[model samples]
Structure formats: C-alpha cells, structure tokens
Target: MDEEKKGTVHYKGAEGGWGSVRGITETWMREVDRPGALRTLERQNKPGGFMCVSCAWTKPAHPHAFEFCENGAKATLWDLTSRRCTPQVLGRHRVSELKTWRDHDLEQLGRLTHPMRYDAATDSYVACSWQEAFEGIGRELRAIDPGSAVFYTSGRASLETAYLFQLFARLYGHNNLPDSSNMCHETTSVALKKLIGVPVGTSVLSDFHHCDAIFFFGQNTGTNSPRMLHPLKEAVERGVKIVTFNPIRERGLEVFRDPQSPAEMLHLKKPTLISHQYLQVRAGGDIAAITGLIKHILAAEEKLWAEEQRHVLDVDFLEQHTEGFEALKAHVAGVGWDAIEAESGLSRADLEAAAQVYVEAKNTIVMYGMGLTQQVHGFENLAMIVNLLLLKGNIGREGTGCSPVRGHSNVQGQRTVGISEKPELVPLDTLAELFGFDPPRDKGLNTVEACEKILSGEVKAFIGLGGNFVRAVPEREKMEAAWTRLRLTVQIATKLNRSHLINGQVAYLLPCLSRTEVDEQASGPQTVTMEDSLSCIHGSVAHNKPASEHLLSEPAIVAGIAKATLPPNPKVQWDEWVADYGRVRDLIEQTYPDEFAQFNERLFTPGGFYRGNAARDRVWKTESGKAEFTVPDHLSAAGFEDAPGRYRLMTLRSNDQFNTTIYGYSDRLRGIEGTRDVLLMHPDEIAAAGLKEGQVVGLKTDAGDGIHREVGGLTVTPFLLPRGCVASYYPEMNALVPLSHHDQESKTPAAKAVPVRIVT
Candidate 1:
C-alpha cells in the first residue's frame, strides 16, 4: 500500500541459509504455542511424527534433524496458528464485507473452528452441528441428479482420504472426480502413460545421487520445493552438470546454501552454484527448445557415425529398449535452426552446447514442472521430454529418467488411488464387486469441463476435500459467478479461503483437521498414509494437538458424507473405515494389489517403501511393449512467439506462497517484498513499451472471443526474461487465462502462455 515503495528489492544472498531461517522464525513466532510449534516441527518427517504438510519431496533413508524447509515451515505453523475463525469471530463480518478482503488477510483470519452454513437472509455463516451439515449435504445430493455433482480434491489430502472421497462420489453414482492435478500435472499423466506405460515420474530422490547430468526445465525449484535444494546442491558439489531452461531466471537454479548444512549456514561464501548453464527460453517454448536439442543431437550422431564409425546416441539401447527412433530422428532433422532459434528465443550455439552436455553425460535425469505442463501444447511438451531422454536411454536406469517435480503432498498419490476423470483408470468391475454397487463407467468432467458444466446449469452440487477451488481456476471471475449458482457446495477444509465466502444456494463449510494435527477416532490415534511425489509410500501420525474439538479428519468427513448420502449397504462399512484408516488402505490394496501389496506392513518402514516404477525395471507396459518415441508433426504452440506487439504472460507464485495459499507479500529471493501485484518484465521491453519502471500499467488478453480479459494496477518491475515474455503472480493473473485456452488432450490451462499487450 506504500506509494513510494516499488516492492522490488535487489537480493544478494544465497537461496537458503539466513533467508530460510528468517522465514521459519516468522511463522514460528505467530503460533500461540511457540514451543509447541518447535516441538511439532521436530517431529516432521520422522517415523512416529507427521510428514511435512507442504511439498511432496521424499524423505531420505537417513533423515536430517530439520526435515522441513521455508515453505514447509510456513504450511505447518499456518495450521498451528493462534487465531481461530470461530462462529463468534465469523459472525462479525458480512459476506459482502469479506468479499472485499485480500486472499492473504482472509487466511490470516485463521483456521475454521466449527461447521458453518450460510444464512442467506443475513449474508453470513452461522454455526451448525456436524450432523446437521452432513444431513443437509445428503438432502441436496439426493435431490439433484448424481450426474450434476462434482468431487474436487486438493493435493493436500492423504491417500486414505482421497480413496474414500472418490468412492463416495462413485457409489453416489458418478465418476465426476476433479482435482488440482487436472490443472497442474494432468498433461504429464496423459503423455507419460501413453509413452512410458507409467503415469508418474520415473526418478526417486536416489536418482540424483548417481546422475552425471541433470536438465531442469521451467520449474522454480527453490520456492516450489526448497527441500529439493539439498540434493541439487550435493549433486553440484560432487561435479554433476546441471543445465536449466526457463523463461525467467529463477533464483533456485542459480545458487543455494542449505540451511540444514551447518558448514554452509555458518559461512556466507559457501553458496553452491546450481546450474552449469542457464537458458532463458521463452514461455511455452519448451517444444521448440527440446526440438532444437534433438536437432543438435541428431547432427552429432550422424557426424560421429559417418566419420568415426562411432555413435553419439545410445544405438544399442534404442534398438533393444525403444521404438520410433528413425521417425523421430527424421522429424528432428527436418526442423531448421532458424525456426528453432526464433521460436525458442535461444541461439543454435546454446542449444548445441546443451546438447553436448546431454551426449557427454553417462547418466542424465530430466525434470520439469507446471510451467511446461500448464501450456497449450502441454501434452506434447511432456512427450518431447520423454523423446529426448529415450534417445539417450535415460529411463529405466540408475540416475537416468524423466522427473516431474510435483507440487503439494499426495497429489500424485490421489490419482494413484483413483481420483480420476478417466473412467477406464478406475477398476469399475473390482469396485462394483467390493462395494456391492455398480460404479459409473462413463468419463467424468475434468476441472475445465467442471467449470463449463457449472456455468451451463448442468452441475448443481460441488464438494471440495481441500483447496480454494474458485480462486485457483482460470477465468476465475466466471467460475466464481457459477460457483454461487450451484444448488449445493461443500468444502472440507482447515482454513477459511475465498471459496468459502462465495456461497452457493446451499453452502456448508465443513471444518477438517490439518494432517499435522492429531486425528483420533473410535479405534485410537489414526496414522494415515501419504505417497511422496516419486511414488514412495509412508505413514504419518500427528504429534500436535487438534486445532478444534469440532474439526474432523478428512477421512472422517468423507465417511460422514457417505453415510448421509448413500443408502445403507452392508458391504461398504463407512463407520469402520473412519474408525481405522488402515481399513481404507486394505480396500486400496485390493484395488491396486501389486503397487500396494502388504500395504500396512510396509507403510511404517523407516523411510517408507518405494511402490516402484515398472518402467525403471525396463518393463514397458505400453501396447508397443517398448518405450515409444512420440514424434509430433512439428513443434507445438507456434503462433504466440511470432505475434507482434504482444508478450507471453506467465502466472507464477511468490516464495511465500504455495498453490493458492499466500503466506505473505515477500519473495525475498526475487527482491519482491510487500506486494503481489507487480509484473516482471525485461528492462529492454519495459523501455520498448514506453513504460517506465515502477509505473502502474494494465495487461489485456484478447482471446478473440469478444470477452474482455484484463488485469490493471500492476507495478512493472524489471527482471530477466526473454524479450517477448513477461510474468505476474497467479490467481491475480488467472483472469488472463481463458477457460478455453487449454491443452486439447489434457485440458490443462495454459497459465504459462497467455498472449497479452501492455497498455499505458
């Protein structure tokens, strides 16, 4: 709110170290139980304690004393906040008044302490009993056609909770299960499953140990998953080559000093350089950049074979373990360097140099994140990454694979246990026999389709296991409008979010427990299971006290709703599942017997058991019986880069934020402090647009649909990026991404590549 402060301050320190410590201290002090918070933090990622409630990075076999990072600490203490959003606390503010509040301020109101329902006449939420809430939700579900309802889950839920949540929806007569993955990594799932036979990332944490070279694309690892800095730093210190391709110069890939390392924390000069070479590729230019890499690689392979009777590519590996090599190589050869340079915003020389790193390294691991996945050609982008790795036989080997750095805990696990839109992924026959009811066989609506259905009056009921749904979606304004039009809306949450204020005709804010807090049922203290981003399964038990006596665990809430909505069935024991979460795991193992074999016994393993990747063992479950090299007709999403007088606007997150949750206004590493309304642009572009630094401007996106998509009041701050690219924080910039502007196959919103113009 300060007119004088531009909110962009130059940062000169290492990624972690003191900056990380300060972050932890800020959140720790906010807890009423400061010492209790410290005690809770100590329990993170330990055998008997709960897993870190933030990022889904795996716990090491030999864990560290401090297993949490800056973001993880914030997520933990956020749940342990002293402030409580009780009935008396909430009643003081009207719905109209709360709507005007900032997303940060709304969450700072603290955890929801009781079940609350909207009072339409008063325009406020009043306290209601859990029983009353469930009964009302049941009545609404029964009234509406089951086809007109959706069950949405955030990545925050445990595997046990996601399983039951999906079951409740299916038994109620639909498979309309949409989740955060539908927005983030759905492209990875759709692409990888088709190419490699497995949907999840191939690399586990151990893969970093043996990797000779690692290529990172589009992911800002430092902020998204600070804990990942440890492995990357270790890899660098030991002389592993790291190459990065991103539109913006993300601080995470530059330098870092792990706070957990005593030697580094005590010395400012001990910062570890992360990337050997950083490429500023344009947003949505992954397709071009990767294609260019392949082009260089193919040229090298031909020269080597012709001149020296040698091979630059893994000729034997490709012959034995892969298919479509000749076709893919031919496709790469056809793409000219000029087009690659123009589209990628990188020179041919840079691509050649990076290609040399790839060819020279014995074992390489390639990783990408939402930036590549959240694009118009998202599915194609992922397929290309796989194609690149396959050329080197980078998969199904030690330290050689394709890795998707996932956001939030259990997001991947949720899909693994059946939170899916695709009907075929769910074992309908098995579920039918197990639950004594017929499971829906039709394909369900994804997030994008869910929004359209809601707007079209086809969807009347909605349920969210966790997350601020309306706030995280594209064309947020339209979705928020349709959200209020729903016949019923239910949110099982730990905190009050913007979605809570946007009430439906019948809205219920069902308070639920954070994973870090104790979850007790009839059997005793329950320990739920979480599958890390890379398919490692582990159990966690809360050590901290519950936020509220009235709040229920996510599993309990799902079971409660199932009981209220479904007719009494002897086969599906909702009460038993709630009382003992392990019962849910038993059912999950029955559904996925191989992956979850000996579920209960192996769950509590010291570092958790790896569910294993079939592709890692050179077992391709694909129809081809081999890893397929998918060749696209050409590079993907080409028109955006060539469009004159326009910039590719990417929606990003601040260091202090996770997903849609904003911890504060500071992004210390990027020199951002006190504001989230700033736009990151190159200095040359700022001058070219006739816009001075620190000047407020507006960005408008013309999707050619007659709908005006614009965001104003952005303070233009100069930063490193491609000439035609610009960046802004998410949720604020969600307006720029039209709902229709998404991948045709995956339906993942192209948040990284919305074409826009700066208007003075």
Candidate 2:
C-alpha cells in the first residue's frame, strides 16, 4: 500500500478493508481469545451473556458458538475492551478534548466503570454511586412536571426492560417515549396503520423461501442484516427472481459466499445474488417509479383481460378484502409518463420491464428500508408500493407481502411489548382492564416531537434506556442546546459515547451489563426474549460471563431506576419483577394476551415463538376491515418546485456500520477500502461542477428549513447512481439535516432526499 494510503483516516470506511486495518485486526483477535479476560467472560453460560449488540437480526439457534456478525463482534469488543471510562480519567479530559475524539474513539473507551455525574462547574465528570445517580435522577424528575419528561428507548432494551419503562412513564403521568424507530421506519408504521391496520412488519423468514419473486428496493441486506445473505442465496438457487432498486451497486446484493456452505467455503468462492433487473432509481423518486410500475401492471392487466379474459389483480381477494380502488386508479391515471420519467430518472421501458417481472412471478415479496422510508412523502411512498403489490393481490398470501427492514434486532419487538408512547385506543383500553389503572390516553411524542418539546423548555428531563439519542437526532445545534437545558439527563447503556458527553444540567452515565454478560436473578441463569426482523420472538440465554461485577442487565437497571423514581405506583411491582424477568413476561401476557400466549412455556422452545396475528392471512386490521389504497401525490414535489443547482442527496449507512455503531471505515461493495469522507456522485456531475475526484467541497440544501451548512473536505467518487441523486455517509452529514424537514404523516426526517448543491 502507498504511504498516503497507509496513513489515511476518514469518517468511516465505505468498503472492504477490515482485514488489513491494524486496530480492527487487533479487536478481531481480542474477540477470538478464550480463557483470557475476553474469553473468560465470553465462554460462560449465563443469562444475558454475549448478545450481539449490533443489528437486532438474530441467528436461528445455532449450537452455542460464535453467533455474532462483524458489527456484533465490534459491539462486543467495545464493551469488553481494556479501555476504561473512569470518572477521574474522563474528568481530566476537557469537554473540548472529549469533543475532538472521533465517534469511534469515544465509544472505544471501555465500560463506564462507575456512575458519573457531568459537573459543569469544573467542565468535567465526577464519580457517583448507583444510589446517588438514581436519587439525583428521581429528585430532578420529581421537580419537573411529569408531562415534561421525555423517555427514550433503544431497540437494545430487552422486552422486560421496555415494558417496565412504559410502566414507569405511564405511572409518572406522561407518555413522552421517543425511540430510535422514529428515525428509521416510522413511515412504514404510519402507512400500514392507515391502510392495513397493523403497525408492524408482517413478512416472515419463511416467506423468503416461498416468494417466487423478491423485489428488494432501497435496502442493502448485506450491510444491514448479514444473516439475510443465506436465505437470499437459497432463493436464487430455487430460481426465485431477485430484483433490486438502489442507487449504488452493493456487492452483497450481487453475490455472497456463505462461509457456512462447506462446498463453497472450500472453493473459496461465493454464489451470485444479483438482481435480474437492476434499476438505479433517483433518490426521492421512488414513488414515481413505483407508480409507473403500477401503471404498467394495470396496462398489461387490461391487455390480458381484453385478449385472454384473465384478470391481473385477484378480483376475488380485492372484492373481499380491500377498498378504495377507484380513487387509487384515478390517481394513477393522473400521473403522466413525462412526469414519471423525469422524476424517477427511469424510462417508461424500465418501469414496464420491472412490472413484467412482478406480473410473471407467482409469489412476490417487496422489502425496503430507510431509503424508501426517509423521504418527505415517505408514508405515501410506502403506500404506493403497497398499492402496487395490492393491485396484483400480492399481500396477505402464502409468500407475498411487504417487508420493512428494521435496523435493530428487537425494534419491532420493542413496539410489540409496549415501548410505544403513542397508545392506540384498543391497547390502552386493554391495558387499563389488565392493570387496573387508566393508561395515558394522550398520544406521546416521537423523536422529533420530543426534541421540539425539549427545545421549547417543555421537557425538563430526558431519560434514555439505551441509545445515542443526541447524536441520532438531526440539526445538532437545536438538539444539543435543548439537551443542555434539561434539568436531568440519564443514560442506561453498556458503554459510553457522545450521548454521555453532551450532558444536561444533572447528567448520569450508568454502565450496565452487555447482552453477552451474565444476567442472573433468584431463579439462577435467566433468559431474555428478543424479536427478530421477521417478527419471530425468541428466548436468548447468554453463554458468557459478565464484563464486570458492577454491571447489571437492562431489565435490572430499569427496575432499579423505577424503584427509586416511582412513588408506590399501582399495577406494577418493580422489585418483584426485577427479581425474575418471568414476572415481567407474565405481566406482558396479561397486557397483550392475544400475542404472547403461554409466554414461559413457549419461550422455552428452541426458536421461541411467533406472536400470531390474523393479518398474516390478509385480514385487514384497518377500521373498515379492508386494506385501502392511498392516492400518490407529489413524492418528488420538492425537486420539481426547487431552483437550479439543487440535487437530492441521500445519507447512507456504510457497510461497516449499523446505525450509529461505526465498527471501522470500510465499505466493500462500493470499493471504498478505508474512507467514509468520499461522496458518491456521477462523474459527469462532478466534472460539470468543476470538482475533481478526491477534492473537498461544501454541500448545502434548500429544503424548507434553510440548511446551508458546509461539509468541507469531501472526496468525490464516480458511481452508478442516477444523475439527480448523490450519496454521503450519515452522522457526518447528519448536521445538514434540518429538524423541520420530516415526513408529513410519519414525522420522520427526510434524511434520504434533502436537496443540496456542491460548493467550492
């Protein structure tokens, strides 16, 4: 390697240089060691030990071995590494010095060994005991109006922990639970809630095996969920037509060499999983492209009906199970071909081609992620996709449905077990009946709402269960300012990060046992339940030791805080529940009896269980008892109405990352070996703008909130993205995201479609 390349360091690498990096190699080696400090803890068979802290995607109960992904390994290394974040050590470092460290460096500093309170007087943090931390939080929280407290939960919080958190918040007389899901898949929930009734993903892992054609739009399965590689590869072998619609070409989408495949592993090669038809659709233009596909499908159906007397849509199913077809048809008719082509950057021919593929396949599945969900009209964009699938009667079938890929393993699970601050009338009523108290009827704040409340001085306390909430929110200035205004900020996490540094007036950083650590109670080794991407709920008992003696499981932490904060709250036995997680599960069973039946018995099963819902059989959970189509309107409206030099930019997670967890700086598929600073753009556009490859340039957007921030030192690279779309890594460019810029219905920031221009 060249000297420059050897010394190179950037935001986070975009591509495959994981093996050669010294720091990463050391971490990997440390991860493999057993019998030593790393191995001593990793090999023990205890509840809550050695859970992959990366993406919430889980393996189907393999023989007690290394069941973690690369990102998961990094998360484990982060918790168990030799680094320590002692109060005195951190106190020595100034706020500016701490701020100077990279996001990766801050997190790499090992476990927060003691509860620490950020002391603004000395501009440093000081050690505090668990009692002191809890008492401080309780005192501050008690002083604030209950409605002014914002409780944030990450997917990493176990089902027990999440339930107790909601209980604590409700008992405290508020429902302001902001979570990571709002930033990722809130659009899917909003669209599905209005159309199909269910606010969660319905697609099962088994559906991947049955689907005759899988249309993966706006998602990179390899980077997001590595475990998906096996199923996709199997589908290809069975002749399932795989189609991908993404701006950049991802290697995992093209082909994957499964290490588990003995034959392929011995050959040192991988099988191809490329899309039979690849469409590099423009960012924010997904709705137009989907609408065009639907139009083509309708056209083909009409032709088939005229000649062969065959209907493309399932007339029986449509008549029995859906409504609003006429309105949807009218909207589709109004969408002109010229507008579709111009907005989506795909020709009518490409739309027709994709439609033909969908039409020919017997069982089709459509999977998408933040790419489709983080747009201005994201909710409507998802509705159109559902409309396309529904036109062909694709949903609620043996092998056809929409799959919204959530980032965390138990994110959907979190919503399932009552992590939601937004209470549906039915659930709230049910909870009231079960718990003997009137649950808060008012809708709670989402991520954006929480920030707005915090900024306006309405929210005085911000308590996070387990996420980098400050870093995760957009427009850092407003968010940071609001956080500092809070009287109390508390984080219950396995390791320290930027969230701890950006403290409120009285902040406490409480370190807890990681998933890989032993979680014990009176019943001996305990097991926690997690929900996977496919809605499969299962038990996970760790086979490892605790990282440190002081560490506690998420459930224990929640219980501890609840014990200290709640003023003899009714309907919840915080101490008893903490004694054993099963009690929490029992309470959950009562609260959501329809889903978690025989919770204890079923959880013992190897794969745990699936929360059964009739919606899987196409029963619309909507108010009218039927799935409804939404009218597509102005998906690319921002682009058309905007002025010149405004390009739609999408922020993406690198292959080496999972949300805010940056393991290293490498993206294998994009061929970005060791840098995240390079922006992916069309060579033509870069050259036209008088910018050369590897040259740093500033980028500003004209999206409603007037975000004209400069992102200098950005290296440009030529990629296969559509002309109107450009790509950059997230958190780095997260500052460019305006807080006011969000989906109308879902309130999710349009991180994928901000209009911007390159500056000198």
Candidate 3:
C-alpha cells in the first residue's frame, strides 16, 4: 500500500481481525517500550495499584491476571513509554519548534526528566535545579498581590497531594484553586448539594449488582467511561433491564461480549445490553424527556390514588420531609405534553414506556454524565432528575440512588480533602484552629473566573498541580491570551502538553511521579486514597518503578514550594508531613472525622471503605430537610426554527478517548472503523444539503463572532442522530464554544449545545 494510503487513518484493510495485535505490536516495537512493562501490567492485577489511570469506576481488588480495558492498557503503556524528556534534549529545540508538533507527538516524545524554566530571550527552555525552580516560583508568588495568583489541580492528583496543595494555597492567602472537575461535574455537584446536602453521588459501585433496572441518561459509557461497562455487563448476565437515553445510539449499549465470561469463548456469543426500549433524545433536550417521564408517572400515581392502590412515592415522607409538593405538582401539570413531545423528539408513548419501567421496578438506579451537566440549564436538568427519582421513592436506598459518574478518579476525593476554591467557612475555621494560622476567608476564583482574571491582567501567576489545563478549557484563543499575560507559570505534570507552549514572562515545568509509579518517600512506599464516583474511599499504592529518578511525588512538591514560599511555616511540620504521606492522611482524619476515622487503618481493607452519609435511606438534606422538586421548563431554542440553515451541533467522544485524553483516532464500538474525521448526521439532512459520504464541508456558528471552526474533508456517516442535529468529537469543535457560554449555576461550559450550520 502507498504510504499515504496506509496512513489514511480511516482505512481498514481485509485483515481487520489482527488490528488489536498489530496495534499492540506496533506500540511496543516502534513507539516505545519500558524495562518493566509486564511488571506494570501485572501490578494492575494486584490490590495496591491505583485505580485504572483511565476512568473513575471502582472495582473490588480481584486477583485476576489482567483487569484492564484496551484504553486503560494504552494509558498505562503511554505513561510507561521508554522515551525520555531530558533537559539536554529540550535545550536543542526552540519553543516555536516544539509548538509545531501535534499534541500526541509532544506527549509521546516522552516523560519529563527534570525541572526547567523558560527563557524567552533565547526562545527556549533550560534546565533548572528543583531548589532554584521552587525559589523562583515562591518569589514570584510572594511578591504578587496574594489575590493575583491562581492555583489549579488536575483530577489525576491523589487525595493527599490535593489536600496539601489546597493547604499551601490557603496559607499563601489565595484560594484560586480551580481544577478539571470544575468543567465536567460541577453542575452535578451543585445540583445534588442543593437537593440532598451532599456533593458526591449516593451509591457505591457494588450497588449496581443488586439493582433490577438501571436508567442511563446523557451518558456514553463505552467511550467516556469504559469501566462502567463491567457493571452493565454483569447486570445483563443477571437479567436486569438497562434502558438508555442519548442523542446517538452507542454500540456499547447494544451488546457486549465479556472478556472475563467463559461462555463467550467457545460459542463467540455476545449478550444483549439495551433494555426493551432505547429513547433517542435530542441534544440539550434531556430535561424535556425526563419531564415527560415525570408527567407520565404523576398520571399513573393519580390513577392509583383514585383506585385506592399504593403508589411508588412515599406519601408520608413527602408530607413530612418535603414542603414543595403542591407547588411541584402545579408546575408539572402546567407543562404541556405537546411541548415535551416536540422538544424531546420522543412521543408521549415512548416516555410512558420508560416511565412504566421505572415505576414497576422495585430496585432502580439513575446515572448521568457530562452530556447532562454541560448545558445552559444543566443544574435545572439535574434537579429535574432528582425530582423524578424522588417521586418513585428512589433516593437513599440499597440499590436505588442517583449517581453522577465523575470524570476523574480522585476528583471526589480532591473535594473531600478541601480542594475547593469556594470551600465552606467551617472547614477554614477548623483548619486554622488546627494549624494555628489564621486562614484566608476570601472566596477564590473558579476555573472560568481565574482565566478571566488572568486575561484582564489582574492575576500574575498560574500554578497547576496536574492536568493539561490549557487543552481542557474552551475558547482556545481567549485561554491562550490569558495565559500569556502571566508573570510566572508553573506546571507539575508527568508529560508535556500545549499548556507549556503558552509561555509566561517566567515559566517553569516541574516533573512529577505518575499515580501508577511507586512513590517512595522517607517513610518508604506510600499509599494514597481516591474516592471513586460511587463515594467509595480506597487506598492506591503504586507498583511500578518511577519514570525518572528526579521526579518527586505531588505532596513533596507542594511541601517544597510551601517551605520556600511561605514564612515561619505556622509550625505545621511541613517537612515531616511531606516525608510521610500517612501524616497527611492523619490530618484528613482530623478534618473529616465522620468518614476518615482511623484513616490509616481503614485503608488496609480491600476496596477501602464507604464514607457514610444519611442519604442512604432517602433522608432529605435540602433546606426544607426534604427532597425538593424544581420544575423543568420546555426548551425550544425560539429562533432555531426560523433560522434558515442552522443546525444543532452536539460534541461527542470517540471510543478511544476518555475526557481530554485522546488514545487514538478510532471508535471501535461505534463501528467507526479507525478515524475521528467523520461527522455523524441524519441521512435525510445530509441528502437535503447535497452532501455525500466522503465530501468536504464547512461548519460555522449561526452568527460568527470571530468564532469560525471548519472540519474540512470530513467523512459523513449515517446514524440514528435526530434531524437538525450533527455530531462530532469534542476539542475539535470546542472552538465553537463561547467563552461566556456556561451553566449559570454550575459555571460549566455548554459544550453540548452549540448552534451551527454546514456550508458546501
């Protein structure tokens, strides 16, 4: 085959069966190989290795030979690559030269070797000792008006590291701690916190095994969260109904052949995953679908009341614990069925069928993801979901609860350890009392607010503990512009990314140890706690060798910077805690007594522990001390109907990706052979626009305010996506997102709803 033909990305030859083997071979032979690659793979099977560095799903510590997904394997391999990123190697290349490389190529170039600083005079980076880098960063931070510094945390950071980072920021008198979770699950946390007085989900992962029915809304489990597939597969084996609501029909929701199940090996049989019905909801129309279902349930409840039969809702609980029942009923009654049917793209009958499933089931679980959270009214959407579940008495039960599948492994733990920029005053007071230093009381900037402050020249320094902050945010131009104005920028990360390209007046890149790498401190190998999406607190110990000898653990880096930056240290014994992470957990135990009691001893148990909350029994923690129902409004983008050529563009994830991490171009389960260049559209719309499968087209927002994004020569695929809706992978169409566009309550960008049109 021609070189271009072979590298076409979308080309799938006749020998498709050997693709996995070929990819493994190619990645091993040509890409890079580690000294203890098999040892790292073996570590994944052990109890102490951190959660799959890929997704947020938590599993029991089974001693299987291998318990990782293909994408997970890829993440591990990529992290453990043989390539090295040394200061000498970086010295040879200019910043502009490195900018020319693709994001993947830059990361694949290898692991960061040592601390370095950017010298704009020479337009290149130079090696700097860790001590010098810390002092330089500390000088910049201490000199700046305390409010002018912003600190960011990545989801990949362990709970212990995040805790220390937040503590250091507090002592420095700046709370500007924004993180990856701010963009993904902030809405879920906000909505749930308002409705239930808790920020995390209610159920544990094991709860899925006991549920008779599972309702998945606004989630693409296979691509965004492959670990969820394990529970769904187990549910299928036990004959549990799994109904899904999404704009696109994901293949993982159709059928799955469990790699662990033996029955599939001999007969090559795949088990069905979708329930009796799969509803195709329009993008940004989840509220409408959920509202229609709630309406159906209300009617059913009325009929049962007239017949003197017991309904699903706990009438006594509603009367005593809740106060807005009458008002909630009035709101649901006033919502017209015609509007619901039109907006949802599902007829009343379709909703009734799904609602009946929820009503009839004795055990139920409702789960959602960013698709529901990244919207203009994402908070309201989640509030409506809570209302639906509350009607059926689903909250606070064994197998029945609401779950927001958090995007990052330890994001929940980060919050638990007080990583919030807007933390409650109580925690601040307690920390001050414990540390004997007055904590800063001023509220800090969120991710969006921090970027705005930076752009306006109010913020002079940016410190990121982990994560590719630049690539994760939207409106790339504005984000890059803000980053350039910084007086000093410091990033502690395992790999190089575009964020490093947006150089500041003085910039530093500090290499850190990956969670999968065994972190050896003065005390020996250390273990950190990560709270899974299900609210399970577990210990993770690294089993692989360090990527580099110079790299330090995130906690130690925080302590080192704190020592150099702050004066007198407040007598907290910073060096001691840095040397021993267990002391950090000891502080966590003091901070959160209800959950972290005996934190060190509890972590020794397999799968760790579940932080107990009262919500496990349907208790209302809302302002009224009861589950409150917020009315769902009918969403009809008023001018969309009249706009001549406008279409709704929904950002999607490819099968090979997991939020900000692009493993490769292929979406295996979607049958999208091997490329992310294809746009999924309804066939009728494609024909109407005079376009073919492999033609080039331009996509632009309705009224371009200098926000024009074009995906030229994109292959078109016919899918079940609704009319007036076009789907493309995210970060590609992320430019279409406006800087000011986000959920008002949660501050999460509206990546799912963008008005656009295709041009020939």
TM-scores, all candidates, are 0.98, 0.93, 0.93
In order, the Cα lDDT scores of the candidates are 0.88, 0.74, 0.76
lDDT of 2 by residue, 1-760 (tens): 1131222222222222232234335566654444354453343222233345567554453323434444555555655566666766677787757887888777766667777787888888887778887787887878878888888998877787888788788877788877888888888878888888887667776788789998888887767776566677778888998888886666567666554455654555544545677787888778888888888888888899999999887888778888998898888888899999988888899888888988888889998988888877888778887887788788877788888888886787788877776776237776666666777878888999988888888888888988898888887766786678788889887667788888888888888877665688776777777776767677766656676666777777777777777777566677678788898899889888888889987774544467865667777878899988888767472333545677888898876677887766766555676778877777777777677777777787566555456676788876666786788988888777888778888888888887777877
The TM-score that candidate 3 achieves is: 0.93
The best-first sequence of candidates by lDDT reads: 1, 3, 2
The residue ranges of model 1 lying beyond 4 angstroms of the native Cα positions read 1-10, 636-641
Model 2 lDDT at residue 107: 70
Point to the candidate with the largest TM-score: 1
Model 1, residue pairs in steric clash: none
The worst-scoring run of ten residues by lDDT in candidate 3 lies at 7-16
Candidate 1 lDDT over 621-690, as tens digits, reads: 8989999998875465523444667888889898989999999988888888899998888778888888
The CA lDDT at 614 in model 3 is 65
RMSD values, in order shown: 2.6, 4.0, 4.1
User: Cα miss at 662, model 1 (Å)?
Assistant: 0.5
**Candidate achieving the largest lDDT:** 1
